[model samples]
Target: RDRGGRGDRGDRGGHRGGGHAALLPPGRTPGGTQHAAKEGRASLRVSGVHGPEAGLNGIYLPTDVESHDFSCWHQNDSFYKVWLCRGPRAFWIFQPASQRGTAQGFMISKERHLERPQDATTWRLWRDGGWKVFSTIHVREASPKDVDSDAARGRAPPKKPP
Candidate 1:
């Protein structure tokens, strides 16, 4: 689903203080591992990784959790939009286009609760038959240099030219 409002900035759910969890940088495993198997285009099992520290803004989903319904504040509109989705295992920060190299999808899950927080935007996911937390990311504010460097390269890129 396109969250952005008719612009590239909103295309990937990018807006000031918009609570959209950022997808894990390509090639980096969710649990912070650096192995080849976890670095490829494999559908990651939620149980494979450890949970994040408490209080960090991120998405969490129980493995057996089949659906998720949640809401977050809209930066531009200053209102909350109810987000809903149903699937085998919930994914917090999902990339819409597998190979488009842009965050252009919606964050979906089952059984969303609570109202939008004015100061902080947060959400949770259920995976591995348990609940987990994930934080939304604001990509538009990212620096051009950083964005270029952070693009998802299926395999590690060669060293930059001097």
Candidate 2:
């Protein structure tokens, strides 16, 4: 630690905000975590220690409870569970249980739902296309305790907004 008290490494490239420090890619951060780059739109990034071989382990899908369909949003509230599988060539698996159905419970089918970014807080699906911004994901994540309760632990979770 230097008498100056930043870091012995000496602020290789960090930014201080609200008394908290965060290191940016190249250098320091300024005024907290600002937009890395002001571009048309950014990639949907769901990051955090998912193993190189790990797919469909950290996050869930926005489609129906199945993954076969290559879609983010469905018409009406129709939703499916899709898993992005990475083997020879990455593909979205509709639902492994689609055939046998969930061994534990019933299937989760939603409708009138359009494809939206799974997490809008971090990214916006941006390309040359135009899309509106809306927090369409009305179904919030249930707490662990709530999920563990027998009501939903073994049975299929109740459809939200019902």
Estimated TM-score for each candidate = 0.22, 0.19
* RMSD list, candidates in order: 18.1, 20.6
Instruction: Note the clash tally of each candidate.
Output: 31, 33
Tens-digit per-residue lDDT, 29-111, candidate 1: 22232222212111111111224322122222111111233221111110112111221222233322121123222332222
Residue 36 error, candidate 1, Å:
36
TM-score, candidate 1, is 0.22
How accurate locally, in lDDT, is each candidate? 0.25, 0.22
Candidate 2, residue 69: Cα displacement in angstroms equals 22
lDDT of 1 at 54: 20
Model 2 worst lDDT run, 10 consecutive residues: 100-109
- How many Å off is the CA of 98 in candidate 1? 8.9
Off by over 4 Å in 2: 1-79, 84-129, 136-141, 149-162
Model 2, residue 14: distance off in Å is 37
lDDT of 1: 0.25
Across 63-87, the per-residue lDDT of candidate 2 in tens digits comes to 2222222222111212323222111
